[model samples]
Target: MTVQPGRRLLLIGSGWGAESLSRQLREQTNPWQVTACSGRQANPTSGADLLLWLLQEAIEPNALDHELGLWRQQWPQTPLLLVLPAQHRYKRQWLLERSVEGLLDQPAADAIAEALEVLAAGGRVIELQPETTSQHQRRGQGLGHRLLCSGVDQIERELEQINAVLQLAPIHPLQRFVLEGRRRELRMAREVLHLLWGQEPIPQAQASAPAEPLQIVLANRKGLTVLHTVEERLAHAVASLDEAQPSPLLALEALLPDRRRQLFEALLLEFRLLVERLQADPTVASSLWSGQQPLLRERALQQLVGAYTQLPKEGALVHLGDALVSSSDLQQEDPELADLLPSLLALIEGRPLLIDGGLQAPDEPAALLHLQRLVSNWLIRNGELISRELLNNCSGWPELRRAVLLPDLLATRQLDQLRNRINSAERWHTLVERPLAIYESRRLLFDIQAGRVEPTMVCDLRDAELRQLSWWQQAFTLLLEARDALAPQVELLINRVGGLMVLLLTRVVGRAIGLVGRGVMQGLGQGLQNAPSSGDQRS
Candidate 1:
């Protein structure tokens, strides 16, 4: 009697023993036509009788689930025969629940063929051994638990560092408040770790709250569950590091009583008004706040306003600019004005305007009106440029706009003073202007040599060496070096003495002479009035 042909079987795996399996099935008396493919390349085909998925050892549960889902989607009606490792017999129930018709433990070619035949014949076959807890699984679980413990230890170390800073470091009150809030978050993260470790029971309040359905499969290796939870919690903790924490200062304010709270509120109001006033005039703000004691200035501001406001520690000026933009009607007039305000504020504050991770130029004509208004307001209130010393130190945008605009703004008030001196009959400009110019030149040269202004451009004097020259040239160069070194000091002295002379002439001498002239004129008029008139002489 002739044997009938076996049904078609689709073999899917990593191609490890797929060819051998296909050959073995083909050599059978009633050979089954086998089509082998990798898991990623497996697709539905017409007249596919059965699917035999050879599961790799140590395969992640998520990956297996994803493969199984793809198999189901491609072949909804086709019977599935899963060839699992003996170690993964624990996953039999999971495979069965996922609508797998057959499960075999590391099945050989004949066994796979038999399982496929049974599945094709509409019968279920489960050759896997009953679920058992092995030593290897216990070791894996122990390692996972240790890893979670290590993560908890790491978090504890970070918390300890924060506590050390709070205890030992001389930090701002606002920094203290922020650090305390971070401490609370770390503490909460520690609680989560403890709960996951099963060392602590869930709180009654939290237990009473409705819990989300557990997505983790119990049939999956316990170690894998622990690893997944650890990964999720660690990621959450890292994300929380960047998130802004709630201010403890606000909580302290909340705890204060009515009278003190009212006083605190008033104090905060005054601080806000002060910040607004400072923002309105960058000159006064820079003079008062931008100095050697920046830390103290920031701390004072934080102590005053941290309770009511959430300002970033680094960019307090930017925060003030944001507030200014929000309070103005510029946004109402034009939507783009709101966007342009930040760039404008940065320009006036002598900071670089960044857009899309690059320096941006403020070349828009529409911004001109607003820029002019801001500058005019500053000038009308007698605001001066942020100290040239500060400007020389900061290497901001080197664009033509900044280079031109800043110098022009500086020259406005300076030129006005120069004009007044030139118009004076005293001719004080001869002595004052030249000394001031020399002092400024010397200062600029010093700044350039010290690597403050125009850092990319090297100073000619910086690399010059008298030793490299001939003897005569060295003598002349030595004189030049000494002169170069002493010029700044000499010019500074001259500038100071010239300033004193100008003050003496313009204020003391000029006021005294005007007083004397007014007195003489008054006395002469009184004498003439006291003298007898012509009519009185005739009488």
Candidate 2:
């Protein structure tokens, strides 16, 4: 079966009102798309795509088992909740009561829409029909379109907020991001995809994204190119993240405080947001791959290992480039990534970065080198430590302070085995317009050390936030002291020789001083005497 690019919701019942509902969805798309199929098709379709097998009545056990097995393959950990029509009693409380992932009944347009939201969030659900639930009438609880619409809108809005937050965040390119920073990548990706929607813009957003002419052309041609490319490479790189965990091994909601439901909501928002951004701007793909911090993110630092593997020229240049550049940072006494500085400024300016232009003789090394060095140095220093925490105060070197807190070195094992399968930079070309920009790298490294890695897994997400605040507080203190030190010195270079001239004339009594007045009178008389003598001499 061809894999659909969207949230694939396959409906498998030809008869009844489903036909009408499908048409309605296609006609007025506030929710999503509908793809319907027959309930009983031979060699049933697999579950990588969503499988909506309508069980109006009892089916052959063999067929049911087969569907179940297929579901296991598509998303094994996620549970499939069964939906049932309440009146058709089967006396199988075991089936009804058993812990399934989710539940649905009669699935009207609203129900279908809600189900899609659940599915997109990686929610556990096994949609059941009236027969399965043993119900007669087609109503468990009626849903109002107004209510469902509002609910979906709120979810979408939250997603928008998350998307903004994620995008605003400084990040490594996608490839290097996954390679060097797994948790941050997941956090960013999850937030981005969570903001996607169909009919409207992100609600309650301070800045409603400007509407653009739909990229039907771009979506069809380059979009297809981008999608296919991103998919293939992502699949190749999946192994690195497999152990690394884009998320927890368990459902986010399984943890606590309404059982991680809030976390799940946030993650859902993130996923939609990412999807929307990609749809809106596919150029971000390049940044995703090239910020090659993971060095391990791909099999080799070079994404196109196979294509350019034998072309020793590119490989040699890049390897030599990295070595010469990174070594410069390593040997410096001050931790300044001078090389990658231009890349940082360009990133701030939001301009396209041309890796090779041969435009002019170089006056400076590239700033991308600085970022790369920063990441590599972070890795090496981290590798030497045992825990995230270092055992010293060393307040002057903030990175070192952060290093002691993290488990020495990056968690390389988390990157699954799929790294070798990826062999091209073409996959990431789509996202390159926005080069990854990491801010406060030293502090982030410190946070990694300090056990404040990312989106809090436990209900205590606030703790991570506090830890971040504390780091900034320390940094601010340092800056504040530096500010005081740098202020210009003042010794009040005062000479009082002209001090009397500066006094207020109103305070004068010499225009108030009687003695000063007499001296002025005497000088005036002398001048009068000299003027007469001058006239006589001239005659």
Candidate 3:
């Protein structure tokens, strides 16, 4: 059956996936032109005339609402169908009921075609039947499945090489994170090498050897059942050890005993505190905001954000910095943080506190999770008492409140205090270019946490190198533009240099040719082929 002549189908997946889908669609005899872009990169209004979008849910849950909220504002009637495992659960039912069409399983080719059919029926929620026909299966599994199946051969080869390297570093806990990253990179790289091999991985990152480890767990590997768990692996290992009765500490020492034990203790302690705090009142989520480190380490954050991509976390913390420097903002009832106040009301980094052992050092992911509510409530609302207000005047996340509140305060103060309180070096430092460098830095921190990236190996100089490259690019662009002003002088200098060289060369060439011609003339006359000359007397 011929599909509609020019029906719109919005796709919001990664570039490679989109390209593969587009190629398959183009081969089809009927209409399948995209009405607009659907991924994180393209805004909704970019091509909204079609009034329909088949968007993929590429964002996280908390951020999803905000991203979708913006999408709805542009294409109000456009429909979204989330793609995830049917087993993967999300509790955002309020959002699901309103916006989502349904879930699409991990992969399957006819799914794209089915989505098109649903879009044709109008943007209402509809269930799509899985095409069991072998033909449909063939169509669905065309390029991606074939590529995945074939590429597995190459990935296995690379994985083997990595496993060999990892064997030498058994104590490296973060090696797991780095390996996981490499495997992910291998997946992403395979997609490119198979499809767009011309495009290269960022040079600096490639040279740096990932700066971290990929987190691969033996027990809780995805696609495994409950029976295949870390506990089970440990149980078997422990049983073997129990029979041998080797030094218990020696075994621990052999397999990342020091930092591993500390991290485990921190995680266990934090999780316990999280459960207790949440159990007391489910709304208290201050534990989510990270203070010791920003999102996924600062380097990765830098890479991910560009001039346009602002950090809400930074926006949250800016005002707190200002409040510390000022006293006028504090009212009689509302006091600024100081030594006079109880330590329970203390602020750590940019996060507010309950200041007991529960809020002590924790793993990066869990620590950051503790800050989310602090961000939503504090940063989103300009540090106005939100979750605190919601749960009565409890001092749960005052630090986050202050942090988000500060960006605006800083913005306001920057304009007024530009001359009074700014440092040139610091300004340039903050305004570093080369976004991927920032992202790498963040990845480094994340890797460090995961036991992939070494903290000592993560040099501040790498950030400087990226920043210098950014400056040089800008400077070179300016140089190129100034070419018009210097063109006449440059051209004149080239001509002068060429003219001198030409004059010297001409003298040597003229002398050699004259010598050769005279020799030839004498040789012919001496051989008795004498001819009359025009200048007879001289001849």
- State TM-scores per candidate: 0.25, 0.21, 0.21
* Candidate 2 lDDT, 443-506, residue by residue in tens: 2211011111122111111233224434544465456556666653322224342465556443
Question: What is the Cα root-mean-square deviation between model 2 and the actual structure?
Answer: 28.5
Which stretches of model 1 miss by more than 4 angstroms?
Answer: 1-6, 40-46, 136-539
Worst 10 contiguous positions by lDDT, candidate 1: 446-455
Give the better candidate number (1 or 3) by TM-score.
Answer: 1
lDDT of 3 by residue, 222-258 (tens): 2111112222322232223211112211212222222
Q: Rank the candidates by lDDT, best first.
A: 1, 3, 2
Best of the candidates, TM-score: 1
Top-lDDT candidate index: 1
Candidate 3: C-alpha lDDT = 0.38
Q: For each candidate, what is the lDDT? A: 0.47, 0.36, 0.38
For model 2, state the Cα shift of residue 163 in Å.
69
lDDT per residue for candidate 1 within 1-539, as digits (tens), equals 23355477777766647777877877787777778877545434545688887776757777777878888887888878877765663453365445566767666777777666656656556565444544343234565576666777788899989989999667899999999999999999888877777553233334332221111111221222322332342233222322112221111111113222222233333333443555577566545432312232233323322334433324443342233223322211210011223543465454544543555333211222233332222211110111111122122312211322334324445434533432461233223432332223221110111111111111122122223434654455456668999999999999999999999999999999999999999999999989998999999
